[model samples]
Target: MVRYFDAELETMPWTDVLAWQAERTATFVRGLVDRSPFHTEKLAGVGVPTGVVRDLAFLEDLPFTTKAEVRESQSTRDPALPLGRHQAVPRGAIHQVLSSSGTTGQPVLYGLTATDVEMWADVIATAFWTAGVRPDDIAGHLVGLPGVAGGLPYADGFRRIGAGLAWIGGWPTERVVELMISLGVDAVLATSSFGTYLTDRCEDLVGIPAKDIGVRKMLGGGEPGLGQPEIRQKIVEGWGLDVLSEIMGLGDVLACLWAECEDGGGMHFCGQRAVAVELVDPATGEPRAWEEGVRGEAVYTTFAREATPALRYRSRDHVLVTATSCACGRTSPRIRCVGRTDDMLIYKGMNVFPSSLRDVVLQGFADDVQPSIRVWKDGSDQVRFDGPIPMDVEASDDLAPDRYREVAAAIAADVRARLQVRVAVTVVAPGSMPRTAYKTPLVHVRETDDDQ
Candidate 1:
């Protein structure tokens, strides 16, 4: 049998992990101010000296940074940071740059020092071991986009494990189906939402269940569908694969991975290399202290990273960090994401989570209740729910509009009554809204009469 796991990283002792992170965190913290200009300004603002953080506790005293700050810095600074005091390594050895494009904000560049690159490869190698990828298995990456540069790590990981690859980036639906059919693909890395879309569409293009296409496992990412049990079941039912690994991280897939171990539990983190995560409250912004059942943000500090390394970067993700020991005999930290910091729609005082809305919609409807929601910038919201109902008043069209109205009203009432917020109800025909290859966004914004 293939090793299927990196014994060195996965089985490292927990005591040693603490020591390792302490040393690296100290070094990284000391360098943070000079490395990025944002941190330098931040240090100046707070009247705190750089290169002063000696350990983990010192991090808490530092002011928290946000995505908005990063964006502002990227706008005015030297477009490309020159090789100077900020440079992590000598100029001659830098091989590749894996930076965020600020699709959401101003793009900040994070370079990978040569050492950072090697560690990244090993981490990725650890990630792919989930698929039981060996020298013999064939792997493919379908959604290797322009930024985030996921293809390289995958290729490097595959090479490290002696696995063969098809080198096919994420393709159009039709092309994806043909390549899988042609190459006899063994493992695939694609977004979870796209996987389901491909499975459903593949049947129409070719009469084959996506599961029967020789893929043993899938590495899913790029959205919130990774940990959703409903979507997970759908992907399995549609594709027929046994293993669906959920990896949650930024564009730099190497930064982190929540790969499922042989056990059926949620994803597990590798503690051997480095990870200093502080799960903070979604509302109050305080560390949850690994509370058993509370949600918080993920502030990550990866000590193993050298090039463009981060110290306590806020991932804008919410989850309950568990200290419960895993049955897999690995003492590494484990995280189960409950929702996203950005995904939550805050209107009128109450926080409405998209995952909560999705769960309610999915469980409450069996028919084509094309569930769609509309939110307004003015802080008002509406929901359009379309599902078949019982025959209460079949004889008159009064019942038609009223029944539809009642259904929408009932959902609105249920949400208001339960979630404690009011929402306008608009009923529509089945198959009204559009679905995308990836997770659907809440695209509609309701406008009031004054604006219209």
Candidate 2:
């Protein structure tokens, strides 16, 4: 049987959903103009009328909010001004302040009121429930420490859903494995990279195979692996998990805003009423229709928020949209992230995502290759690369040196044929690349040529 945390909201018709979103968005914008000085100035500067926004078309008139703008908002330090003029509520009303992971650059700050926190939990819990996690299950939360955006919100979500939660932050892989065994954890919440890493090291750390550990579900996010078919299969086979659901969100916007259903289709938009999602052509910045198989960059706007409300925020995440109704009965549009614009590499007029390259390699050479990969470049500042880009592929530990070389050559040839990009693959021993408790950096550019 299909289960949903909030069936009435999740299964609402498209017309009613849009009506709810429109009403909530207008109210939020009016409150922003009245309470948030930063937004007040921005809206006035843009010549937006000081009234309820009846038409959603008026949102297009407002300037798109960028990460750079949010970062700049933190420059002022006056006590009355607070961290940023983005806060619509007084400081005392804010229940918590969270920071972005800062993987790409400087971390931005986000404040949440009591209501905002409750909404966040509700959305996250709904996502978890859709992904097949239940209240009776014991889940091991494996993510970064509390200060960053990834871990704490999931913990809160699990608690809100009345699940038995184990706080396993900062625990080593061996310790995590041990806890799973001892506690018989039914589900694990972790980044895709960490989940793959744990699966790779599971047999060595513990006496049994990773699949034997008996984790029924792996809830993965914070990166692209779970959405990719080959990578998802690897996790499913390696960990012996029944389902692998990819929950996606941006730290600047919200966590776990979209989640895959048990049917293994694309991730459903869990932020339907609270967040407005749009797609735009990355190259031309023109709005794209949300038709089936359409590809574009994702932009978000908060329909109702008190602290740090965003207006048409550009997410920079390129995605393929599917308007087909999901078998799970959620009417929200589904999306599969193609790649992030920031991480894209343009080569000879073709854009290549590093995750796509990794996925192709994994699909072709699952047995010979390890999940660890690094796309090495000579300079730190370079975004585009010519033919024959350097990459390090980790070979399985059991493979002999001669076999490793052959597998590496074959991988390079396969990637060239499939992705149409030249790659110089160097097969390294197991554990050659660094592993993290959080998201893994697929591309590593050297600071100096001498280092290469």
Per-model CA lDDT versus the true structure: 0.59, 0.80
Write model 1 residue lDDT over 1-452, tens digit each, in one string: 74436676566665555555666676666666676556666656443334544345555766665655544544553424542223445445566765663444445555666677677767777766753456777777675553455656557767776777777675667677678768988778777767767665666667777877777777776666655565677777777776778766563325446666666456667534655666666666676664445567877776666555555667777775655456776666666776665556654656766666554544454232432333333332332222221111111212354467666666666666666655555656433444466555543444669778
RMSD in angstroms between candidate 2 and the native structure over all alpha carbons? 2.7
What are the models' TM-scores?
0.80, 0.91
How far off is residue 220 in model 1, in Å?
1.1
TM-score of 1: 0.80
User: Which parts of model 2 are misplaced by more than 4 Å?
Assistant: 45-55, 396-420, 429-437, 447-452
- TM for candidate 2 is 0.91
- Candidate 2 achieves a global lDDT of 0.80
Tell me the lDDT of model 2 at 224.
80
> Per-residue alpha-carbon lDDT of model 2 for 38-110, expressed as tens digits?
7777778565545544446556666788888888887777575465877778788878788887866888888
